[model samples]
Target: MFDSEIRYIISSGQRKKPICQNIVLLQQWLLEQGRCVVCGSFLTKGEKKPFGTGLKIICSCNQVYFYLPLANLYKRLSQNLYKL
Candidate 1:
């Protein structure tokens, strides 16, 4: 999943600002890292799945979506979009 630095960012309540307005860039960064955007410890996401089920994203570490709002939004959107 996520790395130590990303975990710290997530835990510290400092997650602010969107990582990137352009989802494409965000996606690229995630694929490059090859981990989960949501911390490995996230309870609601289910299993030890490594981000993206059949969606366009491949989020990993590097603290891209430390902003919970953005991460959640992307996940939600991707889930919905994946169905289509």
Candidate 2:
């Protein structure tokens, strides 16, 4: 498994429109499985993109946000497993 640091940034444009910027270490695995965790929409991973080291997840609703680390995802999964 590949371990990399991921970071996210939210920007508000002049029109009050919100845009998300993600910077993370590029990994082949993440590039291959391009899908938003919240919306289940396909995400794009650009190569050699110097924005910084993680995956960016965006949704059309603009009501969802993810600020957790990758480990947190696994942690949540484990917690749910106990309930099953």
Q: State which candidate has the highest TM-score.
A: 2
Return the lDDT, model 1, position 2. Answer: 58
lDDT of each: 0.37, 0.30
TM-score for predicted model 2 compared with the true structure: 0.22
lDDT of candidate 2 over 1-84, digit per residue (tens):
222212323334423221232223222233335444444444432121121132223335332222234433210122233222
Give the Å error, residue 1, model 1: 34
Clashing pairs in 1: 35-60
Error of 1 at 63 (Å): 16
Point out where model 1 deviates above 4 Å: 1-19, 22-27, 40-77, 81-84
